[model samples]
Target: MHGFIGEFFGTMILILLGCGSCASNSLKKTYGQNSGWLFICLSWGMAVTMGVYVAGMLGSLGHLNPAVTIPFAIFGLFPWSQVVPYVLGQFLGGFLGAVLVIIQFYPHFKESKSEEEGNSVGIFATRPAIANPVFNFISEVVATFAFVYILLNLGNFTTGLKPFIVGMLIMVVGTCLGTTTGFALNPARDWAPRFAYTIIPVPNKSVAEWGYAWVPMLGPIVGGLIACGLYTIA
Candidate 1:
């Protein structure tokens, strides 16, 4: 239960700050409007750092992403028994966080004429820059492989500094690889808020672009598993 709650709140905070940054950048009439990719990437990195801090205090490993959780469990770094609870917590938290972003930017959402004009759905989920599923999937796979691999090996860092290092890893990955598919390296980060976007009625919001959703979900899982296998071999 402690793990569940910790994961839940930690993931909630992650999405709250991460997606909140997206909203501020994409939505109209905001201070961070048009802030660009650098701003969003930095915000997401800080979100992960803070979420880890929050979850660590509650005795959780802060696998706020299922891609992270599943790989860790498979590699014996996390208990298999807790996988379901952690994933559930993450998904639920992600959904709620997206809701919070909608509420925070309510006026901007209302004012937008359409998704093309507002890019509202992009605030909630990722879209490929080039609309190529095959390449997009590859991008996610490579990015997530790097993410999980680096994360699993982060123990070399001092305990007190692991979270900050992880944050830097995310920032670097986002800056380097995010353009292709928005670097949706975590399944929970991409999917849960996407599910929320389907239900939440933001004015002129686009259809949730379900066709491209599987790339983010499947690519990350495959990448994580590959990372786990390689880590085990090494």
Candidate 2:
């Protein structure tokens, strides 16, 4: 119960702070930029690290991402039967968190517009810098593979460094691949906030870029399978 709650709350906080930095006006003043990819990546990485640290002690895996949960189900770290419940929790957490961001940015809602060339990109979802699906998919695969590989290998390292290493790995993946697709890498991160962007009454926002949403979702699932396979052989 505690573990599940941790996952639920941790995911909410992760999306709230992580997405807030990109969407919320106040947060942007503090951390946003024309190329704010680094801040987004590091903030999310640190968010996950802290969320997991707090939740892990209570037996929560702190997945925070559907991609992570899906792979765990496939690999038997988590049960297939539990996938829906876990994902439901994650989605709801993410949606609620985005609601918070909406409230935080309520005053700026009317100021935003819906267009590729304007501030719409900041309030809405992200797209690939190069706009090539193949490269974007590969970037996600590599990022997810590295993230899962680190999580798997953390058992071999000192307890104190596990979080740091995992967090740093996420940071690097974002720094390297973030230019493309803003480095979503996590389905829950994208979908949850996207749902809010679509449903909530925000000014001048387009549909959550559903056309490109699946890449982030499917890419990590594929990447996790690859990671699991590599881990199996290792």
Candidate 3:
């Protein structure tokens, strides 16, 4: 019960703050409007830090991303029995967080009349700077692999200064490796909110682009598994 509640609320805070940053940058007539990529990266890093802090305080290990939990489970770093609940919490919380963002930025969504003006799914999910499925998949794999691998070495990142260190790592990853595919190293972070955008009403919303969804989803899993394999081996 504690794990479920912690993961749920942790992931909720992750998306709420992270996607809120995206919306602020992309949506028109906002104070943070047109903020650059650095802004997005930094905000996401801080979001992770906050989420992990909350999750730890609430009793979970703070695996807010399934890419973290699932792979860790496969490697015996975590228990398989907990996988389903953690992922469920992540997805559902991410969805609700995104819904809250829509409510938070409704007027901004109305102001941005077209995808060109930044009213698009990119605010909630990732999109490649250059659209190439093969390379895009490669990007996600490489980025997520780097993220999860380094994360494994952190030794209980949910505690003390480690969460902040984890945030810096995320920032570095986003700045260095994320520019290619928006660095969706977290599958639940991408898909759940994407689903929300597809089903919910948002002013001048763009297509959800489910066709490209597979890259962020599968690539991160594969990469995380690879990281887990390598960590156990080395």
User: TM-score: which candidate is best?
Assistant: 3
Clashes of each: 0, 1, 0
CA-lDDT, candidates in order: 0.87, 0.69, 0.94
What is candidate 2's CA lDDT for residue 109? Answer: 52
List the candidate 3 regions with Cα displacement exceeding 4 Å.
none
Which regions of candidate 1 deviate over 4 angstroms?
A: 156-159
> Which residue pairs of candidate 1 clash?
none
lDDT of 2 by residue, 103-218 (tens): 87765555544454234534435577777888889888887887777777766322465766766777887887666767776787787888788888766665577888778888
- In order of appearance, the predictions have TM-scores of 0.96, 0.85, 0.98
Candidate rank order under lDDT: 3, 1, 2
Query: 33-75 in candidate 3: lDDT tens per residue?
Result: 9889999999999999999999889888998998899989999
**How many clashes would you count in candidate 1?**
0
Q: Which consecutive 10 residues in model 3 have the weakest lDDT in total?
A: 1-10
Task: For model 1, state the Cα shift of residue 186 in Å.
Answer: 0.8
**Candidate 2 vs. truth: CA RMSD?**
3.0
